[model samples]
Target: MTLRVLGIDFGTTYSSMATLDPVSGRATVLRNAEGEEKTPSLVYFGADGTLVGTPAQNIMLEDEEEAAWVFMAPKRYLGDGDFVRALPDGRVVTAVDAVAAILTKLREDAEALHFGGPVGPVVLTCPASFGPSARDALREAAARAGLGDVRLVEEPVAAGHAGLRDQGQRLGNVVLVYDLGGGTFDAAVLRRVEDGYRVVVAPRGLDRCGGEDFDRSVYRWFDGAAREEHGRSFDASDGSFNSPVLRACRMAKEALSSKPKVTLRGVLAGQRHKQDLDQATLEGLIDERIAATVRLSKDLADAADRRGHAIEHVLLIGGSSRIPLVTRQIVEALTEPRGLPEPLRLGATDFAVAMGAVYALVALDDMAPSAGSPWRVRAPGTVFRDVDAPWCPEMVVLPRGRFQMGSPEDEPGRSNDEGPRHWVEIGYDLAIGTCAVSFAEWDAYAPRGSERYHPFDHGWGRDDRPVINVSYEDVQHYLDWVNDRLGLTGREDRYRLPSEAEWEYACRGGRETPFWWGGSITRRQANYSGDYTNAVKWLGEYFKRTVAVRNFVPNPFGLYQTHGNVLEWCEDTWHKDYIGVLTDGSALVKKSSPIRILRGGSWNDDSRNLRSASRNWFPSATRLSWIGFRVARTLIS
Candidate 1:
């Protein structure tokens, strides 16, 4: 019998649960009595000890004093040991207890759906940046909720598993998982093994950052506008205009996400405050916060290298990941000299994590051993095989051939990057890795030797996945190490990036279709966009980070996961007009500018940006989770 497991994502703004349904071979999200897929991670205690959610939010409007027991963002204080003190009644309640009450209610709802039977073991998901103490707090809360046998999984990992299950694909290595929640932001690097997943590194984020900050920026904008119009700022000190004003501000922010501008009309301080807020204005307000996120992501990627690993792809998850400005900033900060996959190819922001959770539940059950510790799994075989010593002359070879390089002129759902079709031929053959180089490969060549090969905390992924989070200088150094070990001169032109033409040529596989497989994109064809056709589809499965390199189908060139695993780097400097300048098959590597090219759409990307012709470029020194590279060698003819 399959032991059912409950998966919970205890988000700061909202919480959701899913359980494996044996009858369906699928995971079902447990809905509340109101038929909601998630419950607000909010708790309210009345003077009479009554608890509520939607009701509490509503009651807080009429009786602010009585609503003193209401706690909206208690999850944010989980490990801080903070407590909410109820006013008037002066009752002290621990954050853990408050969270427990919310979980207890969810447990009741799950029990009701299960016909009063125990739901079995529980799998709880937390932020990747969470430490042991934060995880312990969540476990304690689950225990109070009457759940036994709890196991902890990182939020991004759960989402990545969910994404893989949704597409019916296995997970991959060097996967980047970006989780931006209501109150916090986290990004992680993960690798997929034959049996399960392992975290390569856990990067921290601004605990006080996220969608709420964006909302506040919007609110502050409106407040500034109100002051300019009425000659007086709206009073939030008394809290009279707080709730309605905040609601209006939130709606406006959501509207600006899709629409260019939003209009807000309301009465504040007895004066009608009406204003039209455009995307530019809102983005300007939150630009600093967005830039901060990008910086944090890059710093984390750089830190990953200290541990001796590279980042290949970046997965964007959580509701806040949808902001256009946020996406653009991350792309700009992470884009490198090597060509990278297009940046914005993933799914809608709101559902990625929830969808990923469902996929994770199913995958865990499928991999669980018959008996013993439900948490651990036995490895099928050694993931590594001895390769030639580092600095050895191993080459990545691209065949001299012609392939359809762009989508057809009339292709449906096509984007600007996929157009202006043209083709060329590579007159020479090249040698490349039979598979992406792994951490083990790098360890074999580390200058300090094997004694220094002990696992580094920041370097992520297993030996089988493509190594990621490496810099242009780092890649060059690795190549140098390889050459030195093999007793070869570290010549400049001997090892280099494949030309942009080579990257697209390989990705297209002689086809003119939008994707390597030719037909319209579906989740099964690649590891991008949340599943749109399956139940896991409805649950939202695109990971917020990277996956293993072999998690999905490879292009016809015998390349693995060319489309949506991690963005591979190429040798050319970035030029918007490089396509016009390409008369030969080689990259324009001698440009005066210092930037580099990145190729291949990553797991976080949407389908549109994953097309064969999409282009992305960044400074050579910039490093990010989604940016990783593969090598190409000129064949000795």
Candidate 2:
């Protein structure tokens, strides 16, 4: 039950499988019999039975004419129009059936990796250029593999999904995926957003080009050298492409990725020969193929601009993309002559699609909330409780939705900084601290008075009381310390300050009114000055100073003292207005400012200042008695 879904990157040459546990929020990649996450995307039918993965790939050394029944790179045949490959049993099977057999083997491999029972929801990735028919075929393949409800995602989107927090963020706003695989080449353009990404332009692929083509080119070059140097040539018969000679060529290609030269040796046309091919020779043989792909990628970039997209970085994925020439070509394409960030060569390129597909699955699920969605909502009567870790502050699961982030012009006693109401969309769920971080949590990281201001807790009751008089610099240090202690890293799940938009979004808790509860707020619901109340006819209690967090009722999002207690710091820097802000619920940190934005009213602030749309700013290093901070969980793992 913990395994809610599975993601598979079904590639032409290699495939990988991964599973995500919703409850535990962890993912595991399944390795094959070879003790590797990627398995050969091949299948073979022998006299005894059918074989897939390493067994099939290892057996390629045997005489293919004798083995007879073999299927390699069946992905090349998909959507080729009226294509059906014959099985060894005299019955014919379509490309979908062959691919399904390989996928079925993958699931069996996954089931052996400490997981049992039927695999849950499945997402399969395909080349972006795949049409409706190809996608339909892909779904049918998944069905045959026991994944009946499989969903299809684009390859580049999945690649970006796997690296959004790391390489994706560094790639700027617009990104591209330059995937060169065994059977094809694909170039796509996508726009990065907070939660995931969006396709600005559909992918374009070269139908007749890929790694296999390059392999053929290399094989031909070696064949010619053997003919001239030793008067021998490789067989050009029906089984020549799959012969050991070509296999040697493939090995050289792989080895040459890291080395400058490789020695290829094999029997060819009744003649045994060995040839040392250097990088220069390999480049010469395949330069045209790579050049064609480079041109196509450049065209895709230009086409993206026509659609209002400006590409910032090109990410190289797929096993073939590991070639030095491929990386060099893309780097030159994106940034040549002038100094700029080079193209990204991802270390996780082989598994990017599978991991990214899992991310997409979880992200898409966040958008569609079920009636009893266990992810965002707790029981009706459930209230605030202590988080298990003593070093961490208590947190509440914030709901998912959109709301007006800024205030309207007509709102009462509103600041100009809060006007120009803009609609903000929150696509994912988040966990925010119930209140400002307590002195107990802050001191655990750094003792009182260690900061430049030499601030102290004053022993104003340190246990659950908000830790005030701390600068933004001190707060970030605290975040890094606690995040390191929690073993949180990478993009998705880490402790950090909430963005101004996110703070407002969670503060509103889906309410359109000025306060989470309604259009009005009161001193009774929060800690603030007692002279006036936003709620009419409601007598509110006055709390002149900080109270222990969760001392009062929580808002709809199960958070406490969101209106006042202490003004909290946000991830975004100070901006004069909300004009041209990111519509997605992400912090606006593109331009670093000396002053950072702060939200919520402090103990000395008026009730009008407690409105959800209220905002203010001060020096990043300023330490004040009324300024504190809370943390937000990205939950992206």
TM per candidate comes to 0.55, 0.56
State in Å the error of residue 397, model 2.
30
How high a TM-score does candidate 2 get? Answer: 0.56
Question: lDDT tens digits, residues 184-226, model 1?
Answer: 8876655565555544444345676777767777777787888
lDDT (Cα) of model 2:
0.73
State which candidate has the highest lDDT. 2
Lowest summed lDDT over 10 consecutive residues: which window, candidate 1? 377-386
Residue 334 CA displacement from its true place in model 2, Å: 2.4
**Candidates' lDDT values, in order?**
0.62, 0.73
**RMSD in Å for all candidates:** 20.4, 20.2
Q: What is the lDDT of residue 320 in candidate 2?
A: 84
How many steric overlaps does candidate 2 have?
1
Clashing pairs in 2: 492-636
Give one digit per residue, the lDDT tens place, for model 2 in 130-190: 6445765777788878875566766766776666644646888887778887777777676
TM-score winner: 2
